[model samples]
Target: MRTPLPGVAAACGLAAMLLLGACTATGRQASDGAAVAPSPADEAAQQSTVDTKWGPLGPADRDLIVRVRQAALWEIPVGRQAQRRAARTTTRRNLGEIARRHAGSDALARQAAVKLNVPLPDQPTPEQQSWLSEITGKSGNDYDRTAIARMRTADGLLYASIGAVRGSTRNTLVRAFAEKCEPAVRARLKLLEGTGFVTGDTLPDPPQVASAPLPGNPKQPASPAPAATALLAGR
Candidate 1:
């Protein structure tokens, strides 16, 4: 007789549950008992598809990811270094999960860029259009339509997404960015609140969120939300 791998089975079950939760809006519909189909993230994780080829993220983009993750760690309240470690681990884990599952990071970044008015505060015409088109290139990744993407800039990269997630996992990247990034993200939030994030340009300063301290880290950047976190908060 074979022994049951309870732990392994439990982990797998949790993952599936979380993944389904990622699309709460869609899942909600399914919960209503409509017999909805599985999602791309689920299909990809379960079965390989030749039609979908995942792209490699550049170093700059990865850096932005790290930056945002860090900001999130410090923002959350903690009593010890171990607690901080837990927060960071949680943030990165959730970030990776979001990136893999729902294409969260890109979604937040695109939203933030638009809301924050990512175009340079100086040049406001063709340059902005060119940059906008560059980031918004039609259908870059399956995640592009949904991931949290951070835009690079002279000052720093801009991040955007639709929702956020809770610990253990951020069911939605948007919620993660919103809660962790907080007041600063709100302050750094651009006046472009209405402009198309992927198309509109930033003026100068892009409306700094604050001139004071980071959420939990008062000694941190005046508007110090991670580039990725900022993207989440932007929208």
Candidate 2:
């Protein structure tokens, strides 16, 4: 159930630069790999391409930002628990934490912590998974919360998962993002939102670990709009 996302700029952009693919200012790509996107000089001239959604990142909505980030990472839907079961892993949480911490510990830092902070119940927590089941009753389980019932994990992968808020519908924010959340969050969550920056890689926290198949692993911009594929896993 990976949403048909737009190509991530970094991934696709690098492909264009390194792989010889071409990309446009709005993100569409060309076969030549030599097309001109906005050069730094071009980007420097425009008004700040502020994502209107980030304006909501103010204190009152800290709660929503926390959840939207969470749901997007677990973009799996409901019903088909097996696929969710098949895809479950520590990757999202682990990589997610890394992305955030890479950004610091200060108030201003965590705010920029990219990646969502919505919580997921752990491998040992069926009741919690059940809670998730109640909400998204008709979606794909590939990335659904219900995947926890038969969650799997490999030995080498480290894991961590936690929630910034307690007892949220998780779906509340998912719908917002699925429909349309904020542009800034998508563009800069990892860069300017999450934890304070760090110089080295650190293992994601343990207590936060949850149901899944593999170890942990692991946002946005302004202008016309953002993308679906980019927002999904490939990004």
Candidate 3:
């Protein structure tokens, strides 16, 4: 081939250098991208390894988180409705306070889920939805009673769950969350009880006693009187 012009050769060399530099830069970027901005899954994986202020979360901790989140989602909206439609000032005030607390609780649950890589449901459980629908359709005293009853039922379940988690969870984070939530739930339960709307399941279960001996059955054999009692009688 005829010798290439000096200017053409120079241009060709520069283009090759530019192309090589671009490829090298792209390779560097590909290598560094993961470290520079971690994906949520990546972040979660990293978090799983690191020791948390509370002990590392376990399955029970995750389950508690999901349950609390669902409760919050269900309660907050219904509580708002109760605040607006409840006939009594006390009902309205209590509902308002509960709504505020649940809102905060929901936020905490979301933060925990993100950190733990747990997926949260966007909607409440079906039972909670049904309760909400029932409460939403009522007005005045009817609404008040329904709202309080629903809250009582929910808080009762929540209280039980918290108790279970408190006793079982080893993770400090889960324990802390349950402890923080317990007082609010108990306060709501007490307020609902005061409204007289929580009369059914809220009542303590009747003491379970053994059935009276069947009429025809011989009574349990009486134990022999103590020797001390016999001596006293003789005296």
TM-score of 2: 0.18
Best by lDDT: 3
Q: Give the Å shift of residue 98 in candidate 3.
A: 0.8
Task: Write the residue-wise lDDT of candidate 1 on 109-142 in tens digits.
Answer: 4453343332211112232333334434433232
Candidate 3 lDDT over residue span 1-235, tens digit each: 3343223333334233322321111111123222144566654543343345676665446656776787787788977877778899888888878888887778878887787676777776555676788888998888998777667755665676677667766677778788887887788787777776766443333323458655553566766768887789957
* lDDT tens readout by residue for model 2, 1-235: 2221122222223222211212123221234333346566544432122223333222212323333333332322222332233232342343344334322222222333443342222121222244345434534433332232212110001011112211222233322432333332333233212222211222211222257666434323335546676679654
Candidates in order, TM-scores: namely 0.18, 0.18, 0.60
Candidate order, lDDT descending: 3, 1, 2
Task: Go through the candidates in order and give the clash count of each.
Answer: 37, 48, 0
Q: Model 3 Cα displacement at 110 (Å)? A: 1.9
> How high is the lDDT of residue 61 in model 3?
61
Residue 185's lDDT in candidate 1: 42
Worst 10 residues of 2 by lDDT: 153-162
